[model samples]
Target: MRFLYLLRRPPYSGSLAAEAIDSILVAGVFDQRVSVLFKDDGVLQLLKDQQGQLLGHRSVNKMLAALPEYEIEELFVCARSLAERALSLDQLSLPVQVLDEVGQQTLIAAQNVVMND
Candidate 1:
């Protein structure tokens, strides 16, 4: 079945991003069709130069890049959200579809949708 995972928080804040990534991995293991939408501050998690090593933490970028290996390729990022934060697509490493307000609505109208806190 087709599924969408909506992420709405930044990674460094807490485990929300990590948990979402884990869920996506599990979904992949089960052969479920999964797509991700990084909205709000969640878009920050995809910034290309994440340096968690200095903070003694693992980087989510590595995991983010692994999505394709897990067959989760349909990645989307909220254009307004990214722009509000003054972030550009060049700052992110993942292959993400830039979605405007209209696209976001169409995305949510999919077969299944999941939101991350």
Candidate 2:
């Protein structure tokens, strides 16, 4: 099955981001086709030099870096979200395909399941 995980929360905003990552990893382990999209404040999860341990949390950056190992490589980000935050692709820890409004809609439409966090 194709699973799309839409993350809209910041990494430090409780455990939502970590929970989403865990779910994605589980799905990948089951050999599901998984894709992840970071939108709004969720894009912050992809920013480099995150000090998650300072806040008593596991490093989100390290967690994200493991996605490829699980064969979950369809990572995407909202173009407008990055622009609003003044972040370029170079500022992110992982390389993600930037999607505009229409692209985002198309991707969501193509998913067999969409989970938002």
How well is each residue in 1-117 modelled by candidate 2, as lDDT tens digits? 889999999999998899889989999999989999999999999989998999999989889999999999999999999999999999999989999999999999999999888
TM-score between candidate 1 and the true structure: 0.93
TM-scores, all models, native as reference: 0.93, 0.98
Candidate 1 wrongly placed segments (more than 4 Å): none
Which candidate has the top score in TM-score? 2
The models' CA-based lDDT, in order, is: 0.86, 0.94
lDDT of prediction 2: 0.94
- How far is 64's C-alpha from truth in model 2 (Å)? 0.6
Clashes of each: 0, 0
